[model samples]
Target chain A: MSADFATCYPLKRGRAHEVCGPGATYFAATCCNFSDKPVLWVCPSWQQEMLNPEGFAAYCDPARLLLARAASQIDLLAVSEEALRSGTVGLVVTEIFEPLSLTHGRRLQLAAEAGRTTGLILMPEGMGSNATETRWRCTPLAAGGDSTLQCWELIKNKSGTFTDWVTRWDAAARRIIVVSKTGERPRVARTAG
Target chain B: MRARPVDAPFALTAKESNTDRIQCLNTRAERAGLSRGMTLSDARALRPDLITRPADTPGDAGFLRVLARWAGRYCPWVGLEDADGLVLDVTGSTHLFGGETGLIADMRVRLMRAGLETRIGLGDSRGAAWALAHFGEGVAPPQQPLQALAELPVAALRLDPKLGIGLERLGLRSIADLTATPRAPLARRFGNGLLLRLDQALGTQPEPVVPLADPPQYGVRLTLPDPIGLLEDVTAGTARLLAQLCDKLKTRNQGARVLQLTLRRVDQGSQQVELRLARPMNDPVSILPLFERGLSGVEAGYGIDQLRLSATRVEDLAPTQIASAIRQSQTEDVAALITRIGTRIGLENVQRMLPADSHIPERSFILAAAAFSEAAPNWPPRRARPLRLFPPEPVAGAGPVPPVRFRWRRMALRVAAQSGPERLAPEWWLEDENWRRGLRDYWRVETAQGRRLWMFHTPQQPGWYVQGEFA
Candidate 1:
């Protein structure tokens, strides 16, 4: 845990990254805010929870998102790979239930690199998947009242040193306000309603 | 030969009067001594190894219709003859295949090659053709319909079954026998059907062939000099056909939405690959690659001798004169990607969330099929909504308030920080379909596990329910 990777606020483009833990969707949705082109969000059909435009709009423009409900985990990966390889969309976030193999992860990495599109593989809190470029975990942190805090842990990085950041989601401002960084004293967010 | 070596008897059965009877039988089944009307059980008992399948009546009719369309390669005016036959009016079109005899031979060879044991007849009129094909010699002397029909059984004239039996009882079993007897008596007994049928067969009365409607067929076909079985060759053939078809579509100011590619093999049956586009496209460069993936699913089986591309769905695409800037290319790129992905998974599965003028979280947005819906200008500034919404699952909490700690999806979550009891009431018209009852108190709860879940409590239902996650 070093402060050297502090400026890695936006993940690298044209590569695949793994994001897990409770706030993974938050990180994935925020990734859409970094680019101007369309965003592709692919998930398996059985995952009944859908992106609410109201919540999604707080982080990324809901209009810029193209949601694909793939019939299965295999199709989920397939469609995300196709979307990434097409280079049309600025970003592709694939949500999966099962762990992807290292080879499949490598294939997706290559597809993203070939198309120069950013790809994020989103999974549930404990699910392990091959990390192609960077791996980050998001956990909801305790706060006293009326506001939410999150810890984004950059546990693995290929281009920079490992670092984690604490952030508060300011829904009204529709932005993520960084609260603290690695090795810093944690402080409560000024987000009381 | 593929169906049980072409030696073992096989029959197609249809249920009639609560029992399965043979509707059609192959020559092998006929040689094995099973008749068309025999009960399937009796046939199976007699020939224990006989194979039978329930005949699909509608499917058979569809197959016949396809054949009638295929028959257009020979004659333009082809009409359907019930579910089992095709009446092709090859009157002036016979010269294309050389002569009448050559045409008949050619048709017989092609039909037999396709494994269809067809019965074809040539005559001066429709009645003579039907009668000669069903009863007399397969061919008639030119302009000699009377000579050909004279020996046919009375049933061959398409007579009423009762009248045919009455004619049989009077020893007038043959058409000549009925004609020899005075027409006045036959007409009086048969209600003019006998003489009318006789005149039609004799070419004295004109019988028009009601041709099938040629619906603006945007189709192009390629007949290869030699059959090709490889996937690459099929793809190449598709490209050629696509260009030709796109040209046809362009002249009419239309674009193809659904395209069907049919590949007829050298030895076996044909395979069809259908591609449905997200938008109407008349350009071959854009449409050709869509066929690439679909064509791979086709098993060439033997070499493919013919490829036909036709558009089943077309939309009016008035010529675009605009040379759009950078935005159009990007929009077109996204649309192209949508089409590619949509074609694989269903087009309905790929969607764009369009904002709606509603306060209800679910009603605030609509998922429109990405291919069909225009992209709305990026979302307008709006109220905060949960990232993911769930169908309200009951939280195991007691009161009409956000619990200090609650269990959801079998996980114990301790609520550390929480936001409002934002009051939202059910629309009067939507009360019955409301997700929760009465005024809903909505809360944004942050769990000790770093979960940001959106929960609500119904005042009337007296229960706390988790509906979405913000993370």
Candidate 2:
């Protein structure tokens, strides 16, 4: 794949990606917003209440979004795999708490490849490792002005070098803006009034 | 059939408090001077060795249902007529078996082989069939139901036995005796129900048989020569039945929405597993895995002798266009996958989002069943809202303008930037407990910690509450 294709974040066709940490779900939604195709969102039943269409409507067409609430982690995985393999859907997104094993990840990758669809797995903060092509840890940062800032750290990248970036999502323009890069330094926690 | 000499006297009895009463007696027992409704104690006293077994009402009812299902082979419409009899409407099917006599003979032989003694009755109406089954010795001509039923006893009309006795005592022993009697006086003397039954049987009144369910349009059955207990055998049988069922569905241009698989055990018991699909489907490959999941829970105890696959719910299946290979595979794969997961976790859990007609954030959109409801139409432009919203949580800070700082979830957050004071009034016509706070102004506040919180000020209560978060 070209560097431009790899650089475009969220998820890509015929590949499996994982977004972890506190703002994983937000990042997953942002990824869905970028896709032109319809999205299949599978989540635990408890998390169903958090799916705000108003937030999604900023980037994604609400009419094109489909939701599947799974009763358990196992069902979540199964439904995600099924949705991924279903070529009718352009993107498959799942919120999971359990760690995805290598074999399971590989299976999802193969299904996505066969269907020519994208699979995005959203995991809670501090989940175990998996064999995904790339794993991004996303955390929401305090907003400075009109745009919302999110810290994305590529913790695992099989196809390239690991990297991190501070990006701001411009809700009005419906695009991401790259902020100034910091060289391997911890972020300063500031309070505003 | 030759009548054999009496070897042993036997009767089926039901326990009534402290005594057992004979429900029914065989020919040998009746010949040995026993009668139905006779106390078992009295019958035993009359004959020292009068054999008896407790009545199995539930077993008999279950067997009746089984027979009803079996009768489906002869005709699409079969209903239970009383406890021991079944009514079959073989209107168009009779010709397939060479006529009514042939069908009756075939049923008799099969039922006898199943160890069940049966009596059949064919008529133009349900009441006629019922009367003929119990009274008439041979098949009655369709044109002359009244003539065929005339000589039979008044009990053939299915009147209460007490009422039958009342008519008999009045010199109305046979149906012919009542045919000539005046209707009003006979009804007045014997109650209106007697006349109703007589009219229904004589075809003057309409009596329709409400079948258990509409006959399945597509079904396939497999009877093994020898019972097989292995799971493989069950799956293999299901595959075969599904193939046959799919072929039948294809001919009708229909697809099955719900499938039922019945595994009849060798012990006269059966196990039924039902699969509900997320979408209508006719392909056997896609249907096989769903049955596999259900078959794991089924106990094929003592081996299964028969496997029957039936499409319980069928709908029209539009012919598929010759699409690209990828598109076709994708459609098939998704449908199959949905069916598999839906069968495991239930189809209701699979949902799709649809826009509602309300402006309230909570009521703006609804989750609908994916299998039934369609996606919402073009959604109206939405204002900026939080990615994640929670039940309104109270904030300690209060102010007419945007709060400079606030404490929520025990976290002290300073407002770095404030955006809106968009005034919104509560919907007056609706009774919403959450909106009881009256008019409010919502502001988008960006905190120093990099969290964008959606906080609102309820002017009525003059309190600040954090409602949602912007990603």
Candidate 3:
């Protein structure tokens, strides 16, 4: 499962990855930027909130992302799992309000491994699972004017290691890059003019 | 249309004005003295165990057309007789079935085999056939059609009920009574419609039975040697049928837009499963799963002996276009996946965000059902848009400028950094209720506690609202 996506980044392909806390959806969308294949985003049908194409365009093409709304949590997971199992979608992202059980996480992991597709599980609160390839926490940082700057903490890397970085979406380059190193408490730091 | 044994009390009720009334009843209900136009509750009181179903009038019309096609085996010309009957012009074609008697015998046997009752009539004209089918019995001889029709009731002329009642009140109980009266007075009172009908019945005026246009049928049926009730067996049967139907469609270069699968049970009852395609699909590999999804958990009561798959709606799939679609097979696969997922959670639930031609943030993009839309290669040029945008939730803030501190989504925070009073004017031509406050000055505000929010203030209304978030 430790198929390196990027050398320094705490992420991998063909496995389950968890992104929690503030800006988790944005981080999930950012993760999809790595693949050119179409993304399947699974969410609850009742939710009125959705990704803004204008903002999502800065990271990944909104056109590439297919939104699947399921009426229930089980359906949401089932859709994500099925999409992952199909191996057709480049990335499968699911927004789960309930905690992902260990068995469900393993099944998703196996599904991702079998299909060779990247899986991003978004949650409001973090309960890092053993079956997860990596668990990360994303918090909104200083610059929120024109562009988004966020502090990303790699809480649980696959190799039992920890790494953290302040990142910002570089619009012209169309990629998120590390802005600076941050300790326990993140301080406001300007990365761009 | 499901087949019901004539012995079973079955009635199709229809909403008539204010009350549900029996539109059509089978022999069982009729034997119980339940008649058409009778209130359903009265019929229910007469026969408590009556199997009642609301009639689908349009569906019955469609079924009548199908019945006409079935009757085509007897004669070439088959025209619909109102809603519940069919008129077949078997003028010369009757010889193929040995004669009028033999043709009728064959029709009766076939319709009865299909669990339907038939009251057929062979006559010299369309009106004579219709009248005999409804009010009289046996074929009316062509040379003496008037003599046969004279005994029938006046209502059999297919005149409006009001006219029939008016004629009946005047002591014209039969066609014989109407003809015995003076033609000029009858013409003045009842008008020429009655005469036209009378003439058409007696073979004086021409009445053509215009046959229905037979469209290129894209259907395949497989009757099993052994009836199947298991889902696996049904799935296998569906796959075989799919392969055959796809081959049929492929040769004609047509793709099914809507498919209906009818599984006829041994007990004469039937169940139907329908699949609507997001795109025209000819491949069995792509279409089979959708059918499986549609057919899963469908009750196969008494085991299904016959499986008929018909493409109720089809679209042209030219060879060149199919070749091009295959070249972009990745998209083809995605479309297939969408159809599969759509079968589970509904097609409308799967969506793709498409950038619209609008400056309004909410109207800038639309979530269109992925199955119904083709994905664009790229979006419109990136603007400063929030990561998540929802309906503007009113915040406790005021004035044209961004408030120094405000509450949103139940969180209160002071504004740390503020950007833009980006004046976005409403589209004057389009009346939008939300935009009724008029010009809004948007501000990208960062809260002191580290939350990015897109807030707007209306100059005309003097109120602020939070519309979106960066995260």
Best by lDDT: 3
Give lDDT tens digits, candidate 3, residues B402-440.
Answer: 888777767778898888889899999898988999999
Worst 10 residues of 1 chain B by lDDT: B1-10
For lDDT, candidate 2 versus 3, the one ahead is 3
lDDT of 1 by residue, B255-310 (tens): 88888888898885888888888888888888777777787788877689999888
Error of 3 at B362 (Å): 1.2
lDDT of 2 by residue, B175-288 (tens): 889988999898777788988898888778888766777544677899999999888888998999999999988887888999999999999899999998877888888789
RMSD of 3: 12.3
* DockQ of every predicted complex: 0.47, 0.43, 0.47
Error of 1 at B221 (Å): 0.8
User: Which has the higher TM-score value, candidate number 1 or candidate number 2?
Assistant: 1
Q: Which is the better candidate, 1 or 3, if ranked by TM-score?
A: 3
Chain A TM-score for each of the predictions:
0.85, 0.83, 0.86
Better of 1 and 2 by lDDT: 1
Measured against the true structure, the TM-scores of the candidates, in listed sequence, are 0.64, 0.62, 0.66
Query: What DockQ was computed for model 1?
Result: 0.47
